[model samples]
Target: MKNVLFIAVFLCSSFLRAQEGTNMKRVIVPPEIVKLAFEKEYPGKTPVWSEEYVGDDNDEIRYEAKYDVNKTTKALAIYDNLGNLKAYEMQISLSQLPPKAQSYLKKNYPAKAIKEIAVVVDDKNKTTYEVGIEKDSRFYDVVFDKNGGFDVIIEKN
Candidate 1:
């Protein structure tokens, strides 16, 4: 079960990353509704938007907005075609992570410098933590549950 979940998350993140790469070459304007929703929800913020197609036929569309919450904090918001928020993530300091998560990283990845840490909230309001680490020029996301228990590690391909 754990493996399955890990694979699923990996595939989804990979797809999004792939889509992002593709988007960089060509500008894709988001739907008006999506833009309006974002404006209403986060007034006075401009974001770089990208689209991701999902579902069996890849007909369902999702938009991702990347922006800075402040000079030091980066944030991302994912919304459906109708503009409903699917998930939100924001960068945080290492000290912002749960104590157990910090200890786990210290013990398991000794001497490794963390690249980024984010707190993600899904549509269902479930919270998770993702810690980015690099090894041998490769990047990986080590995810932990709300309570800081180890969840899964997703490697970027």
Candidate 2:
């Protein structure tokens, strides 16, 4: 169930008529609106930004910002053209993941190394964690609910 939205959003974000690719170009200063919004929402935090123009027209551009929320937590925030905060992804340590998610990993992929644990925050602030790991030269992303319930598994060749 969650896989559908995850795949759909990823597909929509990856492809757009105006963009040949979803390359993230680093910018010293983001758009004025994006700067203002980020400042207002997250004061005192330094931000590094990257932007990609999505969709088919001028109105469809999107701006993304990456910054360190703490020494151990990295944040990736996406803003709309108007600078409205759309969503953000937070990278957390394996120990920070839900207990069930951790246990599942230990039992199922004990021999494989755990990579990254990322929490996706949607517009309404709903969150999901995606754990990235590689095995046998193939990468897999396993997502879980906040309570550590299994969600979806995606393989990358």
Candidate 3:
């Protein structure tokens, strides 16, 4: 029928348009450049490095780099594998955290310094933020529910 043929043509055109929109040029960053930047940022701190190769369902490949600044501290840097810095973050403290998060830190980890904070959204569309703390050479990971209430606390000595 003409109606069925028209529907098929419309679906095919839409699919092609969607694919074209998602076709972006691959970005590459060289390892040497990343290394130089890392050194420049951390001056006297030498990095202990490790890397892993990852590929997406779309066949896009990337490299994940991890740098251990010290026995108790680390940094994560992601690249397209050609060495472009896709993302980078340095491990830091609670004082450098946002004001909304500071209140929770002061109340729960009075004597501890928050080393990391991660915000994650689950499949159910619920959002949770996790805070990691360090106290007396021990690490603690605490998760706060969507409402900012304490969910779970994990401690590692």
Candidate 4:
């Protein structure tokens, strides 16, 4: 469900536009309203920014903010052009996973080293945990419900 968002809002508060024809991406400078919104929401923190198109016509853009939440935790917060928070993802330690999730990983993916662990909270406030691991050189994302029940698995290559 790759719903994680938030990262790319401040490294350069400039707009990036893809050149119409060739394979090159053009970097253009423009007023970034999203950066203003982000600053208001998260004062004292500068974030890296990226733009994404959403909606039926792909005409809407969302801004994502990526930054370190703490010395050990990396976090992302996604927002709409209007500054509405769309989702959040935060890195966490394995011990933070629910006990059932921990057991499931140990039993089903024994001896496999975990690559990443994170928790995602959507605009609706629904939460889920995502665990990344590698097997046979293929990376996978295992998603679990907030309570530790299995949700789904996605092959991420």
- Model 4 Cα RMSD, 1 decimal: 7.4
Identify the runs in model 4 with alpha carbons over 4 angstroms from their true place: 1-33, 54-60
Clashing pairs in 3: 29-82, 29-83, 29-84
Residue 91 lDDT (model 3): 50
- Which candidate gets the maximum TM-score versus the true structure? 1
Candidate 3: C-alpha lDDT: 0.48
Candidate 3 lDDT at 119 equals: 47
Enumerate residue pairs that collide in model 4.
6-65, 6-77, 7-64, 7-65, 7-66, 8-48, 8-49, 8-50, 9-48, 9-49
Q: Residue 72: error of model 3 in Å?
A: 6.9
lDDT value, candidate 2, whole model:
0.68
Local distance difference test scores for all models: 0.72, 0.68, 0.48, 0.64
Report, for all candidates in order, the number of backbone clashes: 0, 0, 3, 10
Q: Which stretches of candidate 3 lie over 4 Å from their true place?
A: 1-45, 53-55, 68-73, 104-130, 133-157
User: Model 4 Cα displacement at 4 (Å)?
Assistant: 11
lDDT for model 4: 0.64
Tens-digit lDDT track for model 1 on 80-139?
888888777777888999999999999888555577678877777778888877787887
lDDT of 2 by residue, 19-112 (tens): 3233435575677998999999889998767666545353356677777789866777778778988767777788888999989988888544
User: How many backbone clashes can be found in candidate 2?
Assistant: 0
Best lDDT among the predictions, by candidate number: 1
